[model samples]
Target: MSILATTRTVARHRRLSRLELAAYIAQLEGQNTALIAGNTALAAQLDQAANDISGLSEDLRVARGENLRLDAALTATNARLANATSVGSLPQHVSTQPVPIVQRFESGPVLRAGASPLAAVTAPGKRGDVDKTQPLPVVTTT
Candidate 1:
């Protein structure tokens, strides 16, 4: 072949190769653009999630502190409460004091309201089988 024609063909072939390389580079650039947009969206979502987690962690910390405070207050107040309450000390005062024993008894017959039934029961118009009406006695265990 003539040298001039050979050089022209070689130049044309190189131009075609350059065109193909440019098209491939353009396709990779388009893919990279799409990937950059996807990465940006993902970063935004991750940031929002991290913010939410921080808020929840703060709320949990506050709740734990409040619970500890309440527990300490309750412990202090319980320690301050009295073991027992009492009125003026007297022998009759002992008799008048409220019965602390819980009675689990079911209904025994109640009196008809106007008298003593036994040698001990006391009401309005009653003397028992004993010599005189006396106050119902209460026995206390020391």
Candidate 2:
């Protein structure tokens, strides 16, 4: 009877140990699942940030290009102003000819075809006769 009682006690202990181990395993699996979810969320956020950074970088490049173009134009205008101030002290008289289109180069402002050279020919009062039937010349510049 004493031996039989000891066998029954050992069997009860083994059953309790198995139950504890199963509970521990279940808890560990739950923690692992939570960690995997957190990692996925973090990866998604990192991908979004990378995309935003690339977009901002492209915008910065475009802005820089536009700024360079505007700076060149401003520099050209300032040079033209300085040249005008150095050439003559008095203001020149305003002529009645059409306002000429000015092109700026590194050297200076280039006079267009119908500008200062032909000012005398194209004055408002001394203008030549316009043949209305004639087609206007189409000019192309490279």
Candidate 3:
């Protein structure tokens, strides 16, 4: 071909390549802008998650302290109860005398025979013809 025709052809090819390059650059710029916006949203979400974690950490610390305080209070209460029970219990060597047995019936409470107001009574089957080897059956009035 002649040099002039080749030059015109090269120029046209260059122009078309420049247009294609410009369109590709525009598409790349759009993708870059979308990436920047997505990165900004991700950063905001990360900051929110960090703030929530911080608040929850503080709450856990406070709850642990309260649990410790409650444990100490419970320990002190148990000790005090132990002391009070030990001091309030019945003392030994009060009396060895047996008290009278008062049997309760449907009508009212009645003193058993041979059981005085201040004296003691023998075993249930001792004075009766009941069996001495076998255990007596329990009786319920009410």
Ten contiguous residues with the weakest lDDT in model 2:
131-140
Q: What is the C-alpha lDDT of each candidate?
A: 0.69, 0.72, 0.72
Q: Give the per-residue lDDT of model 3 (tens digit) for 72-91.
A: 99999999889778855556
lDDT, candidate 2, 42-107, per-residue tens: 999999999999999999999999999999999999998998788454555743344334423323
Worst 10 residues of 3 by lDDT: 130-139
Enumerate clash totals for all models, in the order shown: 0, 0, 0
* Per-candidate RMSD, Å: 10.9, 19.6, 13.4
TM-score sort, best first = 3, 2, 1
* Descending-lDDT candidate ranking: 3, 2, 1
lDDT of 1 at 103: 32
Error of 2 at 69 (Å): 0.8
For model 3, what is the C-alpha lDDT against the true structure? Answer: 0.72
Residue 11 displacement in candidate 3 (angstroms): 18
How do the residues 52-134 of candidate 1 rate in per-residue lDDT, one tens digit apiece?
A: 99999999999999999999999877765532333343455355645554431122333444444444434336654434333
